[model samples]
Target: MTLTSKQRAHLRGLSHSLKPTAHVGKDGVTPAVVRSLLETFQQHELVKVRVLENAPDSAKSLAHEIAEKLAGAHVVQTMGRNVTLYRPDPEEPTIALPR
Candidate 1:
């Protein structure tokens, strides 16, 4: 689902205090990384990912690749080597978005 600017901003605020749960290294966006993110999405609608200096691509590109890999995920924010992603659970979403 596409997020409105307000919703994206809300998500960004919520994600500020969160620590990165996944990391992208020189391996880039591997299947293993995608699988880990899928597992993370099961528990939370929003997730933060950190890209190491050795990563193959830029943070924005990696974020998009990550969002593309996950079925309904969206790129919420990308700052420096960090990326915040959002994907509401299909069965029972945890975070509510503003209309």
Candidate 2:
């Protein structure tokens, strides 16, 4: 599902205070990493992922790939050494982005 602008903005604000839950290292999006990310998504709808400098792909590319893998939408707010992704939790949502 696509997120509205207000929902995206709300999610962005919520994610600002959160630290990266997972980090993509030099190996890039590995199976193990993807699995971990999937699990993380279950708990936190909006999660920040740190991308190490050694990662093969750029932050934007990685964010796109991650969003696709999780079947979720992505917002590239920060594109430095880390990239943030916002995927609404399917269950037990702690924060609800504006619908």
Candidate 3:
């Protein structure tokens, strides 16, 4: 599902305090990293991923790639080296988006 701008804003606010669940280092956005990202999304609807300095790509572009690989998952925000992604949990929804 595509998130509205408000929903994306909400997710960005919620993920502020969250630590990076997955780090993309020199390996970049590999399959293993993608798996970890998917797993993290499964466990937590909102995930914060960090792009290390060794990574060859920018956080913004890398975030887009990860989101594409994650199906419904979308990039909420990219701050510095950190990127936040949100994928609603089908079983149990934790975040309530504002209208």
Candidate 4:
């Protein structure tokens, strides 16, 4: 599902305190990384994923790729070397974005 700009901004703010739950490393968005992301999403509806500098793809590309793979919305917020992503959980949702 696509999130409106307002919803995205709200989610961004909510994810501010959350550290990266999973990191995409040199291997980029590998199956393991995707699996981890999925698991993280299941636990926390909104999560921040860190894209390591060593990753082969840019933060934008990686974020888009992950979003597509998981069929979830993607929010890219960057601070220096880290890129944060927010994707809603399909199963048990712990956080609900503002409507």
Candidates arranged by TM-score, highest first:
1, 3, 2, 4
What would the per-residue lDDT of candidate 3 be over residues 1-99, giving only the tens digit for each residue? 677888888887788799999999987899999999877877899999999999989999999999989888888999999999888888888888887
Poorest lDDT segment (10 consecutive residues) of candidate 4: 73-82
Looking at model 3, report the run of 10 residues with the lowest lDDT sum.
1-10
Off by over 4 Å in 4: 76-80
Among all windows of ten consecutive residues in candidate 1, which has the lowest summed lDDT? 88-97
Q: Candidates 2 and 4: which is better by TM-score?
A: 2
Off by over 4 Å in 1: none
Look at candidate 1 and tell me the lDDT of residue 98. 95
Estimated TM-score per prediction?
0.96, 0.84, 0.92, 0.82
Number of backbone collisions per candidate: 0, 0, 0, 0
After superposing candidate 2 on the true structure, give the runs of residues whose Cα lies further than 4 Å from its correct spot. Answer: none
Error of 3 at 52 (Å): 0.4
What is the C-alpha lDDT profile of model 2 across 52-97, one tens digit per residue?
A: 8899989878887877787764763665766777765666667755
List lDDT for all candidates, in order: 0.95, 0.77, 0.89, 0.75
Would you list the clashing residue pairs of candidate 3? none
Pairs in steric clash, model 2 = none
